[model samples]
Structure formats: structure tokens, C-alpha cells
Target: MHFCTKFLIVITAFCSYSMELKQPIVSYILNKINNSEEGTNSRADPLSKNVEGLEKLLSETEALNQTEKIYTVEHLVKSNGYPIETHYVTTGDGYILRVHRIPSSPKMNASNGKVAFLQHGILCSAADWVITGSEKGLGFLLADAGYDVWMGNARGNTWSRNHTTLNPDKDAKFWKFSFHEIGLYDIPAMIDYALEKTGASSVYYVGHSQGTTAYYVMLSELPAYNSKIKMAANLAPIAFLNHMSPLFQIMSLFEPMGNFLANLIGINEFMPTSNFFKYLIGNKICAEDSVTEYLCTNALFAFCGFDYAQLNKTLLLFIIKYTPAGGSTRQFFHYGQAIHSDKTNILSDLD
Candidate 1:
């Protein structure tokens, strides 16, 4: 057989085998759980009962009509009966970021006036923490536990695409930053604001992916900020890129051409969120029960790894509405450089 034909055959076989393995296991486990829960107290088996209840709660949002839904982190928080406040922080470098806060729950104020700030990963926004909604969203859960929940949107994403003078659309300089700037400027500014507002000397910081990268940059560049944070929880923290996945390692080979590729495509600001894409992906494709829903799930698995049993099918649509919120090509290229060079915590080419 021809080389191309042989490759196609192998790819087809792999996909077929993967699907065969995925579907049956998921179906069997779900069916088994449902069968075990039916018409039984099963209180003795709290784990099974909790799993079933959790699944039911996750699916509850699936019934919301498309018209009734407002696709935003603030809307999700408010509609679920939690009070949300929108605050803007201007970074030292002039990028204006929109931050979200769940100040208090119905029962009490922030735990002894404590403050917690949540930061999202690359190509994401503050919406990530609360997108799953009240039942399971970490933002809401933290609020209910009496912690002041604050979500920060880094510059270049959906929420922080503005600057004091530079227009993101017109000024290439506005798109000049990577996650390095976010750590060096944005994180400290937001944290200072949180401390000033809450009168807390320090904050509990939580970050995911590039959020964690920003934290590393802040500590590396400005060690004084360490005294300002009570504790930091890094989720899927990314700094060293010496051991990347095979797929990303291959992509890093083009690091030498990063600037050329970025310029050739005329892509300074990458994947900015807009209403058109929100509707296309959220309403048209990943809408509840849509046939194309699997495309979104498969796409996520392609990059993030596959854990079909842990995938929340119902909130997939809402997540599609908010993600890839926007980023800069340079930010991505920086990661590529790190992976290719086997560097740890190298913020930019100049560094």
C-alpha cells in the first residue's frame, strides 16, 4: 500500500478501537450506578449515592432554555442566587483587567474577613472558576465557606483586553505582552487591590496553568510580593518545559520560526472572544443534546487528555461559550521557546 494509504488505515483503526473502548465502559458504569440507586436507600453506600446526586445536579442546568441563558461568569453567579461584583484593576503597565467577586454568602461575611483570589489559565478568563455553576463551582463553594472569592482575568483574555491609552484593536503594542508581564505587573496589582479593599495584609492565591506561571514570574522578579500572599495554591502549575508531551515537543521544533509564523499569519492577538463564536459553538454546536456536542468533548480530550468518565457532559456547552477567551501569540510562542530550549521559568526572549 502507498504510504499515505497505510497511514490512513492505521489512524482509522486506532480511532475505532478508542471509541469501542470508551463507549462501553462509560455506559456500563452509568447503567450500573443507576441500577444500584433505584428504589433503594443505599445510605450505607454514601459514595454511590453522592455520585448519583452529583450527576443529577450537574445535569440540572441542561434544561435551561437558550433564551434564558446569559453566557457570562457574572450572570452564572447571580442567576444561581449568589451576589457577584465586577471590579476593574489597572495593571502598573496600564492594562485594565476585569475582576469578579463573590463578596459574601447569605449566611456570613468572608471568613474573618479573609480574601482569596482565583486566576485562570491561558486562553481563559475569570469565567472558568464559576462556569460550572453554584453546585460545583469553586467560586461559589468558597463564598459559601465564608471566604471572599475573587476571580482575576489576565490581560489579553476576554475580560482584560483594554489598556489606559492603547486600543487593543489598533495598537500592536497592546498585544506585546506574554504571561511574563502578567506575573510581573497584573498579579501584584490585583493582589494589592484585594488587600486594600479587604484590609487584609495578605491574600490566599489560587492559580491554574499560566496563572501559576505568572505567580512564578512575580516571585522571581519581585520577591517582596511573597509577604503579601498568605498562601498560594497552584493548580496544574506550569514553569519548566523540559519534559513536554510528544505532540507539544514536536510543535516546539518551530520555535526558531515563531516570530516569522506569528507575523505571516498577522496574528498578534490570538483567539479573542466574540459573540459570533460564542453563538456558533455554544448555541449551534455544543447546545444540550446536539449531535455535534461530541466534537467539543473530543477537542478538549485532544489537548487536555481523555478521562471520559470524569467529563461533565451537561456543562460542556457553557464551557464552550467562554473558553479560548483570547490570548497573545507571543505568549504561546514563549512556551514553545521554553519547551525547545529546555528552560525553566524563562519569561521571554529578552530574559
Candidate 2:
């Protein structure tokens, strides 16, 4: 057989064997417990708690499940001289988005009224650029430096989880997107809003990692955005995949199988990275009371929130905070496409 034909055979076998686990096992396990209960007087087995690390996992699960713990302006404004305000705008497709606006720094004044808008990659919200580690996040840092700043959360993250006309959870159309749609849709709406809100004609654009990937798609697909975007800076760019992480290497092995499993389930749905994050936070490594535990997920729970609650006080006092919203499978396809094409292109395959 030809080399290409041989490769296909291996991929076919891999796809046939991989297991797809999208359904929540927690609900299933709870149902099993309830079904086995004897009577009103009967209770869950006292020993149920004796399962290896169940209590610890449950506690961590509770912590990880939290949604949207924001760092208040009281914490943000005083620390940095710039005042911060939040904004919400609807997409052309009529999805209402949640965003952040940081006023320009008082130290410098410019007439052009130019500002920078920062965007995050898949499975991430605006908070990824703003919160956690060091007081001046990407958002505040730009604002405090005298450039007005706008931070955006792509659809499906906690904040942008609403629609002008379509509910993402209820409308299949809302979820029908690859980073292609994101680049084509979300970024423009954000730019128009930033310009209108800041009274600027054009703004500087900077995206890190996946953020940069979207920029390339938007620029190539909608050339107009290229003109609107003055100075697009792509950090750690991934237009192609020669330098992909080891994780993607594993994915390459199971791409055929994973694709089959993916189709069997549905679109925009894959094993959420949080399952892994939950595993880390809920296992013995769970340290709700410890600053170290909270920092570990500074990327995931940041959007779900980890501040000011009955949560491990360490989650609250971690002093520094940032949340990395998880990405959908569509984003990964965009990454894969860019890497495969050896240039940035719209995400058309996986949505």
C-alpha cells in the first residue's frame, strides 16, 4: 500500500477505538445513588463518603463549578489610577457580548484618540488578559499607560453568554461557529463598539496565541477589518503547526478517531478542558484553603469566579487573579487548519 494509504488505515483503526465521553458522569453517579436508596428513612450509605478521595473530589468539584467571580473596581481602580468600566454590545448576528473598557491614562494625552483592543483565544474570556498575576493585566496595563483599552470575551465564555436575538444555549445557530465565524463576527463587533465607545476612528489590535489566529482569519476573510485594524500584533503566532504542543501530537494520532467521536456527539461540543481542570482541583491536590490551588486554575475558574465567597478564602485572597475561559472544539480546528495550511485561514472544517 502507498504511504498515504497506510496512514489512513492507522487513523481508521484509531477512530474506531477511541471513546467519546461528553455526557456528565457526575449526574449518572448521583442518579445511581438515588435509585439505590431504600426509603424515606434510608439515606446514602455513610460509607459512600469513604470512597477514595470522594469527599475531596466533591469539594474540589464544588469549587470548580463556580461561575463568574469578578474582581471589583474597588480592587482594580485604586490599585491603578485608571478607572475601569464594563460594557456589553450585541453582535451583527444579534448576540449580546460582555466586555471591559479601561479609561486612558491621565499621564499622557494624544489627539488622535487611538486605543488598543486586546482579544483572547478559544476557551478564554476578557479576564484572561486582565486578571491574575501582577496588578496591571493586559487590559489595565494598556489603559494605565494612556491608551484606552477594551477587552473582549468571545461567545460561550461566562460574560458574553447572552444574545441580542439568539440564546446560545437554546439556538443551535448561536453555537454554529468555528474561530472563522469568531474572527469574521465577534472581532468586528468589538472593534466597532470600541471605536464608537471611545470615539476613535481606528484602534490598535493585539492578540496572543489563539487571539492572533483569529486576527489572521479576519484579515484574510474580511479585508476591510485589515484597514480598520491599525497595527495588528500577533504574539506567539500559530499560523501553522510545526511548533504545536505535544498535546496536538497526540491529537494527530487520534484525529481520525476523535473526528468520528466528535461527529457522534455534536458540534461545538468536545470534552471541556475543565474536566481536566476539575480533576486537578478536586483531587488530593485540592487546596481550597491554599493559595497554591487557586493559582493553578487561574486560567479556568477565573471566569467562573474565585473571589469573595465561602470558597477557600485562599481563592479570594490569592491577591492576584485571572481566569482563562476554556475554548470550544471549533477553536482547535482553526488552530489545526492554520498549522496544516502553513498560513492563517478561516476555520471551516470543525464547526
Candidate 3:
């Protein structure tokens, strides 16, 4: 009798599971049959309508919500319900840069009224400041804190690849600039634009990596712009690279032959926004569920420190898609020169 009871219990559980699995299929079949019987004239099934409504709602919500992430800096800002403005500045040498601005925020009502210029590092764009989401992104945080934030993209990057005269795609002259031009031309144009628009005498300048390098260049080459800066903050400053990481140290060894390598690759604009990265790296290797995700993390660990606690595993996918956001071969070659010479000089006197 106990054996029979156990068998019954197993059979009952199986039947219940089968019903659960078959319900959706059964409903679909029934709906089709009912629709056919209705001679294609009846109003749509309410259930079907509800399901369609739900799907539409989800797509719309996802469009507005950037929790999943996006590639455009301005869209990323708007999706987070922040005010964003796109300003184009023509540099002294004719490089047209796309600058992003968060004019004000609900958090502080523009009470501070001071302009804060945030510049991105090598191979990056204005998007870098706002990619980490609103809560953590420097751009958003600054806006929330009452400062008018302006994020600048250096020339040869994804956004700033435009020029008044030359074409970025076909013209080698378009890609001829290094960070020196960025500091001399790009910074002054962006800073002057921001000040003109906001009517602020001087901006609170903040830079990261090559951004800091550009700031130093600006101050050194054009001392007149010094009066236009309220203060300066440099993050991970790239002033003196005498103690650069082993990875850069190895890469710098090829600085002498940088021109040869650049020619070999036919790389005028290096690593622009492309499908190669989006489909290959973003959707495949660096994807959260991908088996080869470690390659992404490990690569960062190799360049940056291997601090597990600091790594945001999910954010890696977004970073991979947006970054290597295009730069010139000369820009990187300059850094390689700096690493070799153990100096902050933009133009190497070693030649």
C-alpha cells in the first residue's frame, strides 16, 4: 500500500508539471482556433492585446531607461532624465570637437553658477564621464551638486573626428594631430565656448590621464588661458611617466618604429566606433554571460591594478562597446615617447 501511495504521488507530480508546461501552448492553440472561427472579423483577443501592450510597454521603457546602457553620451544623459546640450567648437587648427553639457539639475537649481569643464583621457570621448550611470557618473554628480558641467572630447576621438576642411575618413591630415594640438587648440576652444555661453570668467578644470596632460600643455603653451581657470584637478595625472606600468614599458619599446607600425596597419583613425567592436567584443567576449568574459577583465587587470573589489563585472560590457573610441596613431606615439624619455614633454626633443 505504501509503494502504491509513493507511485501515485510521483504520477500526480508529473501530471501537475505537465499541465504547467502545456498551459501556454494550449492557450496559444485555442486562441488561434477561436480567431479562425471568428472569421477574421472579430475584435482581437483581449489577452493577445494585453500581451502586445505589455511588449510595447517594455520596449518603450527600455528605450527611455539606460540601465541596459547606450553608446551616445547625449542619449545616455537624457535617458537618465538629466538636461543635456551638445555644443560644437571649432579649434584653432580647425578640428571640430563635440562638447557635452549638463546646464543644471533639479538637485541644486543652478545656484552654484560656476562652469566646470571635464575632459576625457586618451582614446575616449565626453561619454566617459557619464557612462557609469547617473548616480556614479562624474558628469551627473557634478550637475546634481549645482555646478554647470561641460565634458570635452579631444580631437581625433569618435565625436571630435570632424574638421572644417579635411575629411576624417579619407584625409591623413585630419589624423595628423597629437595631444599637443588637443591642449593648444581643443582645450582653449572648449573652455572659451563654455565661458562665453555661461558668462563665467574662469572654469573649474578637471582632467583625467591624457586630459591632465592636455591641461598642462595648455597652461605651458598659452599662459593667457591661466586667468580663465578658477582651479584645476587632475585625476590619475600623466605628468611624469618614469614609473609607468610594465605593459606601457613594453609598448614604449616600439616607439622608435611607431611610424612603421602606423603605416603597416593603414591606421589613420585608430579604433573608431565600429561594428567590429560592438558585435565581436561588446556582444560576444565582454558580454556578462560569455565564456570568454575573463579576457576583458584580465586585460584591464594587466593595464590597471588587479583589485577585484574595484572591478564592476557588468559595466565591462558597456565600456568595451564605447571605448577605444578612436584616436590618431600619433597621439599614442606621443605617450610612448614620454614613457621612453621619462619626461612630460609632448614634442620629443630626442630627435
Candidates' TM-scores? Answer: 0.77, 0.65, 0.77
lDDT of 1: 0.73
Candidate 3, which ten residues in sequence have the lowest lDDT sum?
1-10
lDDT of 3 by residue, 1-351 (tens): 123223323433333343344434323334453563465625332222344653554455445445434568888899888989999999878888899999988677545988899999887888888889889999989889889999999998888889999998888878877888888899999999999999999999999988988898899889999999999999988878875544466668998797567767767776686654554456544667443344455455444434658888888877876787889878777777887766656544223
Task: Kindly list the per-residue Cα lDDT of model 1 for residues 120-222, writing each as its tens digit.
Answer: 9888989888888777888888888889988999998887889999999988889888888899999999999988888889988999988999998998889
Which residue runs of candidate 2 sit more than 4 Å off their true CA positions?
Answer: 1-49, 56-82, 105-112, 133-136, 170-173, 270-324, 337-351
| lDDT by candidate, in order shown | 0.73, 0.56, 0.73
> What shift in Å separates residue 339 of candidate 3 from its native position after superposition?
1.7
C-alpha positional error of residue 195 in candidate 3 after TM-score superposition, expressed in Å: 0.4
Candidate 2 per-residue lDDT over residues 1-351, each given as its tens digit: 123223323432332233232543334434534453433324343222344545565565557544423343234543556556778887777767777777665555742366899888666666565454335466656665667878777776656767767765556566656676677788889898888877778889989766777777788778887778778888766566665653353455555555456556766543333433434333322345322232233322322222324344444323223333444565565455444444434344452
Give the deviation of candidate 1 from the true structure as CA RMSD.
10.7
Off by over 4 Å in 1: 1-69, 242-247, 287-291, 343-351
**Residue 37 displacement (Å), model 2:** 28
Top candidate on TM-score is 1
- Residues forming the 10-long window of minimal summed lDDT in candidate 1: 1-10
lDDT for model 3 comes to: 0.73
Number of clashes found in candidate 3: 0
Error of 1 at 174 (Å): 0.8
